[model samples]
Target: CNAFSEIHGLTPCYTLNGSVLKDASDTISLDLCSCDFNADGYRLPTEAEWEYAARKTISGMQSGLTASGQVDKYGKEDTSIPEEEVSWSASNAHGSHKVGTAGSPFTEDAPPVAGSGNPNGMGLFDMSGNVCEFVWDWSGRYIESEPGERASGPEAGSERVSRGGSWSEYTPFIYAGDRYSYDPNECYNYLGFRFVRTVK
Candidate 1:
């Protein structure tokens, strides 16, 4: 909700005299401040910010380490069942039902439905299975870069970013770091967003 408001709250200021200046004087709810304001209010999370948050310890799927005897819902070694193998999707939902209607006990043959069960490694809920979230990057193709522990993104002025698969999306695309983009002016119910703020 905060994400939606931050982007929506700051409607561009237009005037009959053609004088235009981006306004940063107004304030909306901090809950709604999901964007990055130049120096004012709030805005959507940056691509780097979003990725880091999504993959961070508090709200992401912890990978790399061996499943190390961790057993999946099916009692298989965590390593035997990769993250990709245990994810959920729209088809898994059988349509779009309310969250948590499917109960738990996510099995290998029957993983939990989208929005109907637990979240991934991240503390965040409904990340992969709820609704697709709008990101701050531009619409364009992606090429996973190489060689860095953590990278920011194009040059800061290039590209937009949206992540998380929506209620209607398939399973393969629901990974936390999956991304998409669109024109800022474009609008759609299928496309909503969440915002973040840095207190420092």
Candidate 2:
């Protein structure tokens, strides 16, 4: 996570777009260097862990979905908040803000971002606003196809999970439970990520 590194003054280390998944049976000699992650017990966040931090709830997408399973802003619900309460959406943002920008829609007068409106019960900042965050899971297409109860992601390979919405879009739909996937090492100027540390 770049934010954590910036806050702690640690040099960020990562190989852009390395192997997707490494299993016990895989026999490939690739360079796995020490990025100083071991010192802090740092690593990528699991799907559940990442979702918890992003939405603070286990429900599903903040926007309601249609009968066809397509994500839309009809009858969506945020389990983190009241029956239907949302802080971030495409209509409220122009692009990713600096962080902690508060205003109904985060316009020019607002803090420049969303989450500042109020943090979820978990006290996690920017869970639904600002730049989207990434998870350790390999993009799982279906719930049944997932690895296991604690499945990190698709065991078959490399794609990472992306959550939350960007500040540039204008839709109140991409809330918790709404997930996307991207290449692990791939970095976008508008895309950044946060990490979670497991206590156990």
Candidate 3:
């Protein structure tokens, strides 16, 4: 949509409108098809991809890893650092800020400007907080077994899964491992998404 282009200078021809396909919205239409790496376009990330990136360990970006070999599940896994330092929650922000603005005593009701909050081990910002991101999976229970390479969720479901807590939610809901779901056609002010593409 124009939001991505206006904010990040990247644009996709598709939007949420149901103009591309019959009897389905844009998100649902795209969800019906498997991702093609040869195609030059944006797509949503799978649930596994989102969590791995959120929990990954990058040398120079973040240090949430412990001696026990446990990586940070949330962006603020290190107890030594205050939660306000890495996340925007009720403790600091009563509402969303810009995208990446950093400071103490956050009282604004706006999302932070991008890349302003704590970057995760993958050097990606706002992986734990900001706005909950929608993934390309249907809502379902987790299976303990490995899902093979590039695993996705069930083929059909009533609700789509969203990960990461939003700016309007509390701290408990904003963890990297936390998940929620909503109707595919529903839209909220606190809801947003990120785009992913595979290299050929």
**Best by the lDDT measure:** 3
Q: Pairing residues by index, what is the TM-score of model 3? A: 0.68
Write down the TM-score of every candidate. Answer: 0.50, 0.56, 0.68
Go through the candidates in order and give each one's C-alpha lDDT: 0.45, 0.48, 0.58
Of candidate 3, the 10-residue stretch with the lowest lDDT total is: 61-70
Deviation in Å, model 1, residue 146 alpha carbon: 15
- The segments of candidate 3 whose C-alpha lies over 4 angstroms from its true place after superposition are 1-33, 59-77, 101-113, 143-148, 170-172
* CA RMSD of each candidate after superposition: 9.1, 8.3, 6.0
Using lDDT, rank the candidates from best to worst: 3, 2, 1
Sort order, TM-score high to low:
3, 2, 1
- Candidate 1, residue 112: CA error in Å? 13
- Cα-based lDDT at residue 131, candidate 1: 52
In model 2, the Cα lDDT at residue 167 comes to 54
Tens digit per residue, CA lDDT, model 2, 47-66:
67666554432345333221
**Model 3, residue 174: C-alpha shift (Å):** 1.2
Better of 1 and 2 by TM-score: 2
Model 1 — TM-score against the truth? 0.50
